[model samples]
Structures are given as structure tokens and as C-alpha cells.
Target: MKIAKLAFGLICLAILASNVVTMSRWSEARGVYDDICYLRQAHLFQRLGLGGLNTNAALDYDGYFEGKMKQIAFAEWQDPIRWPCHNPMPSGKDVMQYPPGTGFLLALFPEGHQVAPLYIAASLIVCGLALSGIAMARTLPSLVGAGLFGALAVYLMINPAKASYSVAPTMAVCAVAGFLTALWLTREKRSVLLIALIGLLLGASVNFRLPNALLAAGYAIYLAVAFLRMRTLSAFAQGLGFAAAVLVGMAPTLLAQAVNAGSPLATTYGSADVVAPAFDLAVLGQYVRDMQFVLIVLAIGSTAWLLRVGQGSVRQVALVVAGNLVVNLGFFLSHPIFTPYYIVPIAMLSLWSTSFARLMQPEQVRQAASLGREPTSLGVPSR
Candidate 1:
């Protein structure tokens, strides 16, 4: 078993090294409109600090946005109103439509050399998580499963993730959140603090991609159901704590919306993105032929497998994952648009949570079953 584990660990390391090399060769000016917009946001933060949240086109006095647009041969490069991702507001201000998180991450590196380092760093963190998952496996089959999944997760950093700058950091968050979800669900005693931390992580994800807010659907549904059934002050408090933490985590995006859109509840996105939800066969067809469908199938199969064989907290974790998959998939499938990376976050989160739950089952089965039971206080299992 040790020998197999060693071999898999080395394979993961090799994959990580290859990912680093690939990332290093990436060019920041890839002629993508989104990349230029994200870099402009980073330039704003670097220049204006917190004041960068107000992403008005007037801030581009130094011609940073113009330079990027011209590099792509944009016909209207001289006009801010003609920018690809910037939305014109009723306030007569054209603002970048993306959330501030990815730009903030890019700003951490020096100008003109940000994309490579950001992706390389994200790949390293994901590789580390994969290795840790491998280490936690107690049996041969589990070890191999973790090793394979980890390798694939690391390799994906360059494909669909590279298609959008926001996806890089979002992938890292999903990896960490999946592990934490398993840990919180399988513990003998429920911890409010743990759930709050998970909420904060999901909330922070919104800063990267606005749609990531849907990632909390499963957690919210599970907690709400738990509280309603138990009807205890502790259960209520637990749910409340988680909700508050999410709001706190989303503070930056909210502030940006308020500053740019005239209200926090309002969106800075253009009309095309604000349309009503309706099932589109073309969009559905795109997912059916894409890699995301394969992942969704895997997530469903894994959740069903866990429910069939798992006991106590393991079953609870499976239920949460199942609900999350249903909600997120429903939204993306019905929407009028389709993207390669649109469903990746939910798929990865469900996969990671289930993978970790399987690895921890031996210990989790020994713990007392507390989920859906009456708690003593603060939602902690009564000893």
C-alpha cells in the first residue's frame, strides 16, 4: 500500500510540474476581451487601492484600457463605451461587469506579468489538496480513486479554467470547500463555527464569479431543513450564523455594486445577462456534448453510491451534495447561455465532498449519528 501511495504521489508531483511549465508560457495579451478587462481592473486596484471599486471608464486616463484594446485591433479602441465587457449604466458610467475578486488576485503580481503567476499559484494549491486527499485514503481502492481524481483536477487548470481568468481562483475555492464540507458533516459534534467558515468561503467565491453565489444553495437548503425539523434555538442559531458569515464574505462585491450601479441590490451586468430563466435546447445540447456532462454523471453516481453504503453522517453529506448538484445544474441548464466552465464549480465541489467522505467513512461510521436528531444545545450532538 505504501509503495502504491508513493507512486501516485510522485505522479501528482509530475503533473504539477508540467502544469507550472505550461502556465509559465502563457501570454497575458491573448487577444481575449475578458482578459484585458480583468487586467484593467487589476490596474485600477494597483493605482487607486480601495477606490478601485468604482470602476468608471474615466479612471482610464493613463490609456491602459486603450492600449489593451488596440493590441486586439478593436475598431473602437479609443472609446470606453465600445469596451467588450464594460456595461453602460443609467448613471452614464461604463463599469467593468466582472466582480472584483479575480482582479484583486491579479493585482498581487506585478503589472504585465500577472496571469502566469496567478494560475501557477492556483495549480500548486490544487495539487497540494489532491496530494492531501491521497494521503487520507485508508485502503487501496480509495487511494487509487483519490490519485486519479487529483490528477485530473490538476490537469483541468489549463483547459476550461484558462478559458476564463475567474475560473482559476474559483477552482481553488471549490477544492478547499469540498474538503471542509466533508469534515463539518462527518464530525461527531456539529460546530457552528465550521459551518460559518464554509459560508464565508462560498461567499468569497462570489467575488470571483457572480454565479458562484448559487454554490450555497445546498448548504442553505440543508440547514433550513434541519432547523425546521428540529425546531430548536440551537438549530436556528446555527443557520443564522452561516447566513451572516456569507453576507460578510460578499461585502466587497456588494460595495462595488452600490458604488457602480447606484444600489447594492442592483447589478452592474448588461441586459443580456439579466434575462429571465427559460430552458434552451441549444444550451442543453452544448452541455450534453461537453466534458461537464461527464463530471455531472460522476457526481450523481458517487452520491448514489455513498447513500447506498454510507451510514450516519456519511449519508447526510451525500444528501447535501445531491441537493447542491440538482440546484446548480437546474440553473445552468435552463439559462439562455452556455460556457465550458459554467458547471465546473458545482461538479468539482460535489466530487471533492464525496471523495473526502468516502475516505473518512471508517471513522465517521464509528461516530454517533446526530444529523436530523434533536440536539442538546447549539446544534451539537448530545453525548
Candidate 2:
């Protein structure tokens, strides 16, 4: 297992280096719309932390930050705040669209390594998700579960339209991080350290994106309730401990948002609470169109698999995914505008649903662990 993980890590690193080179060259030539915005945000993150960037420069959509490198050069040569070529964009100034967590994470590297960090992080996430799927597949005696996981990861990583978007990396990172944490929480019975680690990872996941944090919180609550129902006081206590760790880790980002925007929920793009019909629906429609391929297949497959593997913890996880989808869609429909990235909460759920089947306590696994597997009727395998 260690050797397989090491091999996977090496492959991910190689892919990361290649993708970084490609993205950097692409940025050098003619950067895409979001790349310009992200690179500029990267610069801002380098200069100021979350508070200053959100409060001061977020409203300047057409400021010197909108242009590629040349625009910044012109801005410096002319007026730092005013660039002759800078056009007035309706969206206004671009703050970091994601939560401060991701920006601060990217800021750890040198400016030139900006794109590389995203590439590395994204690759590592996909690899982790793949490994988790493999673990689940081992229990099935068939490749179905693992195959689905691999397909989903590839779809997320290389899909043309999604790859072009700014939030894809976040989607990948949150999905893998959430999956690993979920496995850690469930697989080991009730280990305090593992539970704490799970909570910390969940917090980190949420810090990257707000919706992810919501999803993790829901799952944590569900786990706590489950443990309490089983009368496992220790497990329940561990769940609470994990939740507290998440709160502690997430405090800074939430505080930054409140200080800067008067609302911790206010994202760099806009608010999540209000829905404007015209723009919101139009954007949602466009996003659904671009993502129709994987999204539809994943939705169908996840539902069918969950139905086949229903009851207990698997069902609980499925319910959480369904719940997140409902809530995320509601937010998208209610918002004044939709960004495809907003659908990420749903995507993360879909990935979780796909990977969680292996965590089911199959008879063989239970026997091996000396835990009683649910008995089968008529000599058939346990349902």
C-alpha cells in the first residue's frame, strides 16, 4: 500500500510539473479571462492579506488588475491605480473569488510559482481521490467502484470547459480532502487522533470554499448523531472534538470576510444569499450545458449505486449528498447571478457518493476483522 501510494504521488508530481509548464506558457501568450483575474489576485494576495484586498480593491473590476502582465506594466509606468488600456468592466474590481483560505495557501510559494502551486495541489487531490477509490474497490471483488472513481477524477481534471474555469482546482481539492477525511472517520472505529485529523481536514476543505465547509459541517453533524444513537459516547465526543477543530481553523477566514465585506458569506464574486432570475438562470443554464456530460452520468450512477448500497452509513452519506445538491441548487436559483463554480458543492457530493461504497462493512471484511458481518438469509450474501 505504501509503495502504491508513493508511485501515485510521483505520477502526480510529474503531471503537476507538465501542467504548470503548459498553463504558464498559455498565460505568457494569451491568458484566459479567469487566469488574468486569478494571477492578479495572486499578486494582491502577495501584497495584502484577506482584509485589505476584499475591502479596498474588490470593487475595482476594471482597475489595472484586469489586464495580463502588460497591463500591470502599463499601470506601473503610468499611474499605479490607473492604466490607459484598462476598460470599465461591469463586474467591477475582481477580489479573490474564492475564500481567503485558498489565496493564503497559494501565497506560500514564490510569485513565479503561482500557477505551479495550483497545479501541484490539484494533482495531489486527484491522486488522493483515486487512492481512496481503489480502497473501496478492493472490498467489491470487482473494479466497478474503483473504476467509477477513476473516471470521475479524470473527468474533473482534464475536462475541457471545467479545466478552463478558475474553480476546478478547488473542486478537485475539496472532493479528495473530504473523501479522505470521511474514510478516516468511518474506517477506524473510534480513534480520537483520527477523528481530530478528520475534523482538521474538513476545516481546511471548507476554508478553501464556503460551500465545502457547509457540506463538511453537515457530514460531521450526521456522524455525531449516528454515534450518539449507537450509544458510543466516546465516538460522539470525538465527533464534537473534530467539529471544534474545524471551527478553530476556519475562524480567521470568516473573521476576514466579516471585517472586510460586512458579511462573512460575501464571496469575491458576489453575495450567495440573493438570486437574480435573469442572470442567475442564464448562467446556470450555460454551466449545466458545459458540464452536462459528466454531471448527468455522475448523478445517475451515484443514485443507482446508492440505491443498490442503501441503509446504514452508506445511505447516510447518500442522504448528505442529496441534501447538499438540494441546498446548492437552491442557492444557485436564488442568487442574482450564478458562477459554474457554485455547483462545486454538488460535484464534491457526487464524488463522495462514488467513493464511499467501499467503506461498507462487507462480510469478508467483517470476518477478517473479527467483527460479525450482518447475516444473510437463504444462504445469500448479506444485503
Candidate 3:
């Protein structure tokens, strides 16, 4: 087992090194409208600090936005009204349509050299988590599974993740959240701190991509059902704490919305994004034909396997993952747009949670038995 673990760890490290090389060669000016808008948000933070949250077009006095547009030969580069991702607000202010978190992350690095470092840092974090997962595996099969999944997860940082600037950070969040989900659900004693941290991560993810808000659907449903079933103050408190933490985590986005859109609840997105959800067969077919479909199937299969063979906390984690997959898939499948990275977040989250749940199952079962509460196949106490 030790040798096998070491082998997998080395494999994961090799993948990380390759990812770093690929990311280092990336250029921020890819002629993508979204890329410029995201970088503009970063430029705002670098120039104005917290004041950057107000992304009014008038603040582009330095012509950074114009310069980026011109680099791509955009015809209306000088007209803020004609900007690609900026939306016109009712208050007559034009604001970048994206949430501020990605920009905030980019601002951590120096300007003109941001995208490569951002991706590298994110990939490193993912590689670290992959190594941790491998270390936690006790058996050969678990060790192999962790290593393979970890390698795949790290490799994805460059493929679909490279598809969007928002995706890199979002993937890191999902990986962390997945590990936390396993830890929180499997423990014999519940930890409010763990739950809150998970909520905060999920909430922060929304700042990277709006659709990431749907990532919390499974947790919400699970907590609600648990509280309803127990009718206990502890359960209710858990739910309340999670929701509050999520709000706290997403506070920056709310503040950005308030500053740009005149109301915290108002969105800065254009009409195309704010449309009602409708199932388009074409969109569904696109997903079915994409690599993301493979991930979705894997997540579903893992969830079912865990539910079938797992007991105690493992089963609970499976239930949450199952609920999450359903909600996230439902939303993405119905939406009119299809992006390569759209469904990747939820799939990765489910896989990470399921993987950890399996790796930790033996320890959890032993702990439950020691507490005189042997878990039945249905995940309830045998007594």
C-alpha cells in the first residue's frame, strides 16, 4: 500500500508539473471579450482597491479597457456602451457583468502577467489536494482510485478549466468544498465550523461564476430535510448557520451589485443571460456529446455505488452528492447555452466527495461501532 501510494503521488506531481508548464505559456490577451472584461475588473481592483467594486464605465478614465479592445481590433473599442460584457444599468451606469471574485484573485498578481500565475497557483492548490487524498487512502484500490482521479482532476485544470478565466478558481473551490463535504458528513460529531466553512466556499464560488450558486442546492435540500425530519433546534441552527455563512461569503458580490446596479438584488448581466430557463433539445444534445457528459455519468455511477455499499456517513455523503448532481444537472441541461466547462464544477465536486467518503469509510464505521451505534445498510443506527 505504501509503495502504491508513493507511485500515485509521484504521478500526480508529474501531472502538476506539466500543468504548470502549459499554464506558464498562456497569454491573457486571447481576443476574448470576457477575458478583457475580467481583466478590467482586476485593473479596477489594482487601481482603486475596494472602490473597484463600483465598475462604472466612467472609471475607465485610464483607457485600459479601450486599449484591450483595440488589441483585439474591436471596432467600437472607444465606446463604453458597445463593450462586450458590460451591461447598461437603469441608473445609466455601464458596469462589467461579471462578479468581482475572479478579478480580486487576479489583482493578487501584478498586472500584464496575471493570467499565467493565477492558473499556476490554482493548479498547485489542486495538486496539493490530490496528494492529500492519496495519502488518506488506506487500501490499494482506494489508493489507485485516488491517484487516478487526482491526476484527471489536475489535468482538467488546463483543458476545460482553461476555457474560462473564471473556471480555474471555481475548480479550486469545488475541490476544497468536496473534501470538506466528506469530512463534515462522515464525522460522528457534527461541527458547525466545518459546515460554515463549506458554505463560505460555496458562496465565494458565486463571485467567480453566477451559475456556481446552484452548487449549494444539494446542501440546502439536505439540511432542510434533516431539520424537518428531526424537528430539533440543533438541526435548525445548523441550517441557519450555513445560510448565514453563505451570505457572508458572498457579501462582496452583493456590495458590487448594490454599487453598480443600484440594488443588491439587481443583476448586472445582459438580457441574454437573464432569460427564463427552457429545455432546448439542441443544448441537451450538445452536452450529451461533450466530454462533460462522461463526467456526469461517472458522478452518477459513483453516487449509486456509494449508496449501495456504503454505511453511516458514507451513505449520507452519497445522498448529498446525489441531490447535488440532480439539481446542478437539471439547471445546466435546461439552460440555452452550452460551455465546455459548464458542468465540470458539479461533476468534480461529487467525485471528490464520493472519493473521500469511500477512502474514509473504514475509519468512520469503526468510530460508529465504538460509540455503540452500528450503522445499518440504510445508514441508521442498528439499535
Q: Compared to the true structure, candidate 3 yields what TM-score?
A: 0.95
lDDT (tens digit, per residue) of candidate 3 on 137-233: 8777778889999999999999999888999999999999999999888776768889999999999999999889999999999999999888988
- What lDDT does each candidate get? 0.88, 0.53, 0.89
Candidate with best lDDT? 3
| Error at 29, model 2, angstroms | 7.5
Arrange candidates, best TM-score first.
Answer: 3, 1, 2
Model 1, C-alpha of 58: deviation from truth (Å)? 0.6
User: Per-residue lDDT tens digits of candidate 2, residues 1-383?
Assistant: 44544454455545545554655554422444445544554556667655334534444445545345464353353232343222222344423444556556556678656655565566556656665565444333334545455545544554452343345555665565556544543342545675566556656666566665665545565565667666767757777777887787677567655555456664434433333544455665676676543564575567566645543344445555555555555555555654545555456555665455445444444343344333332222122
Going through the candidates in the order shown, the clash numbers are 0, 10, 0
TM-score of 2: 0.67
Write model 1 residue lDDT over 1-383, tens digit each, in one string: 88988888899899889989989989998899889989999999999999989899998999989988888899998888888999999999999999899999999999989999999999988999999989988878889999999988998898889999999999999999999888888776778998999999999999999999999999999999999889988789879989998999889999999999999988999998787889989889999999889888988999998877666677788988989988999899888898999999999999999998877753435332224332332323322
Give the higher-lDDT candidate: 1 or 3. Answer: 3
Q: Where does model 1 exceed 4 Å of error?
A: 362-383
Where does the lowest 10-residue lDDT sum fall in candidate 3? Answer: 374-383
Position 301, candidate 3: lDDT: 96
